[model samples]
Target: MDFARTATWATAIKNLNPDNDLSVPLSDFLRRGQHFAEFCAFSLRESSLCDFLGEACKCAAAACNAPMAKVLQLGKSANRLTVIAQWGMGHDVVGSDAGLAEEGNPPGQALVEGTPVVVPDLSEWPDARVPELLRRFDVTTSINLPLIGRSGPFGILEVDYPQAYQVGPVEISFLAAVASVAAEGIELMSQREALTVQRDLKEVLLREQQHRIRNNFQSIANLLSINAVKTKDDAARRGFQSVERRVFALASMYDHLLGLHEQRDEVDLSRYLGSLCDDLQQFYALKEQGISLHCNRRLGMTVDLNTCTTVGTVVNELVANAIEHAFPDGVGRIEVALTSNREGSVEICVGDNGRGTRVEQCNGTGLQTARQLVTHVGGTLTLQSDPGKGALWTISLPSKGHSAA
Candidate 1:
């Protein structure tokens, strides 16, 4: 069977009416059509080819009122058909193979001729192609329908009865419809398996690439650290260390990437920010200067890698600036807090209880860089300060990567 034949059968099934002059009852046509619809509706619930085939065999059997049914597929060599699914049959009968050359094998004949074969009375028929196992079970009547796929006939659907049942055109048409569904299911299952394999391979390659990039970033940071230690000038040493920390901040993005199997471009904003703050505290020796740094706890929120990197860089520069310029006596407190609202907007505040200076009074490039970084990612940065009070730098980010007013 091919798509054309399948479409013709579907048309016949759809045009079914009680007034038509048909040998079979109208109820049989309606019932069989219902079975086809039900099978199609629930097919997605099947997780594997074997499971789908099993349900298909059961549906075929129930649709035809047969006691036993089985499905056979042409082997890779195309010389034999192997039993892949069965209903109301012993487990031992599954996985059995039937040669295409067998004189009376109905399934083999169906596959070879690309048509259905009906043995209404196997006992009276000459050289009937019934399997030996069916003979042991006293199967007297059987019908084999070719399961057609996109390429052509690929398998057979066989239904057997214990009594010498009279097979009719209605039964044959219904079984053919069932066979079409089974063929389509088998093809879909094969495609799904192939896609899963491809996705697994891609994931492996991505992980390897991320790992190599992370290592390279670490190497660059290490070289910068070494140079920072060997430098005699305090300003040059500080510059080297600052560049090294920025490199490390970028590298940390890949650390999150390596652990993710899906959503590779998104990072856990809460966790990443917390980790960055801890690293900054240790690197700047905040505890030794009695300048305690604290980051408030936040619920997990995810942001894209680009946005995350930009926010991290801004935070790094602002924190470093606060440590260097805000606390003149090296004795003050700094707090970092992240908050999100129902509108999906995010706000980050880095505040310090130290002698404050207005934004225009600052001379370093750190504050300028931080403001530019925030604006580049469609966010806003503002500062609140008084001469003897503290400085509070607040960053506002809109949802969906939009700019805040």
Candidate 2:
């Protein structure tokens, strides 16, 4: 596996998409690719197949010593080769217009005829549209091999080399192996995308389920609050205040979850956290008289519904706990900041200035539960009281691609 060959192949590919902004030259393409069997193994990984497709194309081109290579997909209308992955052509032209004609399109024909097609000097022929692009890439000869999958003809890998270097039987056999990886990569890419879509759909369904359930529970809580308050006078009603606070907490949590856009597939953590703070301020302003919740900036992170629930629940607990225990005199400020760090982790800090608690004294049941949830997700939660001032609870959580479906 020579790196020079890989570089040539990679150059041919990098030029395909004029919109690609990446500047990593041949750094990622020098692997020389193990055997063709490794292609199957790598393509089977459920991740970014765009990388798989591009890298596999380059690997095949390098292995064959061809000047240019392309992994072309078939269109539905018939006899159409869509250049999904490419490696050899120097020009920006793609698809049938790149040089492969309707008739001399060796790769498309091979994919359709279920056999390999070889043209020693594609540019030498009078009917070849690829000559201009071929000359630009310094390609003299080329071969197209079909990559057949479990279904039918998936796509074809076309390789172009110097004119004197004609493709022999050994090269065809080797390309056949490369095409196998290409086929598997395409299949795996399709499967991965489908699985991702299914997982996202399931999250949406789960969020919808949570919304309905929370709404129903909130309705019940409101009814119970009214009934309990009605069944007693001022002294008994005073006792029911805690119950009402708990009910409001539950109601706020449910309402927030109910009014989200999970169908859009990504959750904005900053907007949600801010809205939660806003809801708490509005809720406690009525309960305790007058207190303001303030935050410096709008913060956000794209996350899953489950992550949203966990983070939102913890935020509610901390902010609400602050409102309840610390600032009972009704005049204070709650400060919050959410940051998505340069290292890809998100940090959320909810602090207040009125009253604070010591670390030992702040270890209540709710705080303990919140800490457990944060730590279980491979993150940390810390609470510090300002000693005659307000308390600050900071939660740092890891936001990966996402959990399972």
Candidate number with greatest lDDT: 1
TM-score of structure candidate 2? 0.50
RMSD of each: 4.7, 12.8
Measured with C-alpha atoms, the lDDT of residue 105 in candidate 2 is: 57
Local accuracy of candidate 2 as per-residue lDDT tens digits, 1-405 = 323223223322332333255342253233334545566576657556555776677777777665567767676555456666666554353543333325555554554555666777665655544535455666667677666555556666778776667555456655655665566556656776889899999878987888787777677667766866697577576446545655666666556655453344566666667777777767666336566677654444666656666777777778777776777677777777877666667778888886677787867777888888787677789877767767778888775823222
Off by over 4 Å in 1: 1-22, 44-47, 90-104, 121-132, 151-153, 257-268, 278-291, 297-305, 324-332, 340-345, 355-358, 361-363, 386-389, 399-405
TM-score of 1: 0.81
Q: After superposition, how far is residue 218 of candidate 1 from its true place, in Å?
A: 1.5
lDDT (C-alpha, whole model) for all candidates = 0.75, 0.63
At residue 38, candidate 1 shows an lDDT of 80
